[model samples]
Target: MTDATLAFAHGDPHQLRGMEGVGIAHDGPAPKRIVTGYGFWIFLLSDIVMFSCFFAAYAVLLGQTAGGPSGAQLFDLRSVALETGCLLLSSFTCGLATIAAGVRNERWFQAAMAVTCVLGLVFLTLEGREFASLVARGAGPTRSAFLSAFFALVGCHGMHVSAGILWLLTMMAQVLAKGFRADIQRRLLCFALFWHALDIIWVGVFSVVYLLGSAV
Candidate 1:
């Protein structure tokens, strides 16, 4: 190209965002892992924003029982505690899986991921049972504003967990087929980030929706 064009390109301040230095630029696109992680982080932030709205709705409608049962009457603390344990254990195993991925240990990665998936399944099962019991008691979402908000907030988190379980299995399948290829590793990293964020959101659910709601 011409010197003037090159000068304009090299001197453009906007280009500095992608360049390592003022004049020098990366030879190719950003590393796949970094780009993948950044994109997934944005996805996570958007998910959090969605959950924040749910939290606000639940908070506002917390006391709107409409003459039906409320959280204090419907929530089974024992079941919720067990579900929390399962998720916490799954998160731990997920961390181990991430470490195994970093070390390129196929066996440990598969085993840890399997354990995480099982724990997540157990969590979902317990949550499903709890919802069933509530519905059987005529305390379904349509029963009251409180029930609707409660179901929306908790069910959103449960849906994320369900998606995470699916993603974990997909990651496992790809690892077996691809054997930790760079792209697969980046996907695994994103999976870890997504799973951990779910756990964080669940903690909020436990604290605000369960603990506080029960007391109120």
Candidate 2:
């Protein structure tokens, strides 16, 4: 082959090998994605610490009824059962949504995510109504130390669920706009972790505040 033809066939040498002297700039001191993930982990750890403290406080205040309604008098196991089922189903839907994202099935992802969010909202609504009814019946947080602990522990968990719903909605918007890109998928996974962690905490609350408390 002629020299000119050979060079044309090869194309730009640097281009073929990849960009030269581009020196892929580090966006900042730390890689943006790695730093973001590390920061999220730290936040989750801090949350764990907070939950631990709440758990300890609840334990200490477990039997302090102060002449008010005790867990056996106040807790409705049937309602708690329903709430637990709903939250568990929501967690399942969230998993399905993540799977849909991985497969790049936008419709399934959106549908599953919407279902998850709806279920989460339902759980929160039920919890709020339950709290309201209790308070209306003169069993509010101020009723006794036990009630106060109950409200704080369970209420904090409900707040986490609320925050998670918001986060899920935000991620849904991102997915709709950008489609399931890697970064967005990662964020969704993290949100899933957070959601499931809330479920775990609820299990503990249910056992300590409802089941065991009833037995006592």
Candidate 3:
């Protein structure tokens, strides 16, 4: 036989011996884990692109007050500041949840995630109330181009938070049922990244849409 064929014959062509008797090792590189991470990152990038478009639209319409209420007149800086703090704290707790997951501390992970979800819900509630109050005062999105843009930007973010809350609950269920399996851990990681990204987006909203609105 040729040298190549001899080597292949003698060297375990299937390369299965190294993984013999080890179930986890037989799994080999965990393609699911790798793909999960990659797919989640791609999703996050796409989400960032979507948010960028919203930001650009807001920028284009920032000054289009159209004889309606301006941001300074409609925005409540104190409320915005409170919402910002809640989101920031939720982001921090989400980080803690991820850390707990990594350590396989299911209790801490679930608690942290629960806290994050509650804070996210509170933020959304405040935002909804603000919108309702605006509409009650005749400052709805249809009132002007600026209000339209404002509603689009802030409302899109609230929707994201709502989605995150749903995801958090789902993850909690998974943790309770599965005890932080590898796939569950991967999903939690993705959720953590998404939740934190929403917090960062809210920071931008508060700064550009609220703080600057107050100043200008």
Write down the worst ten-residue block by lDDT for model 1: 15-24
Residue 172 alpha-carbon offset, candidate 2, angstroms: 1.0
Taken over the whole model, the C-alpha lDDT of each candidate is 0.91, 0.85, 0.86
Worst 10 residues of 2 by lDDT: 19-28
Query: What is the full ranking by TM-score, best candidate first?
Result: 1, 3, 2
- Pick the TM-score winner: 1
Q: Which stretches of candidate 3 lie over 4 Å from their true place?
A: 1-31
Q: On residues 12-61, what C-alpha lDDT tens digit does candidate 3 reach at each position?
A: 65654444454423334657767887888899899889888988888788
- Global CA lDDT computed for model 2: 0.85
Q: What is the C-alpha RMSD of each candidate to the true structure, in Å?
A: 6.3, 8.2, 5.8
78-195 per-residue lDDT for model 2 (tens digits): 9888898899999899889878888999999999999999999889988998899889989999998988888998999999999999999999999999988878877987887788
TM-score, prediction 2: 0.81
lDDT of 1 at 71: 83
Off by over 4 Å in 1: 1-29
Candidate 1, residues 130-186: lDDT per residue as tens digits? Answer: 999999999999999999999999998999899999899999999998899988888
lDDT of 1: 0.91
The TM-score of candidate 1 is 0.86
> Distance (Å) between predicted and true CA of 138, model 1?
0.7
Can you list the residue pairs that collide in candidate 1? none
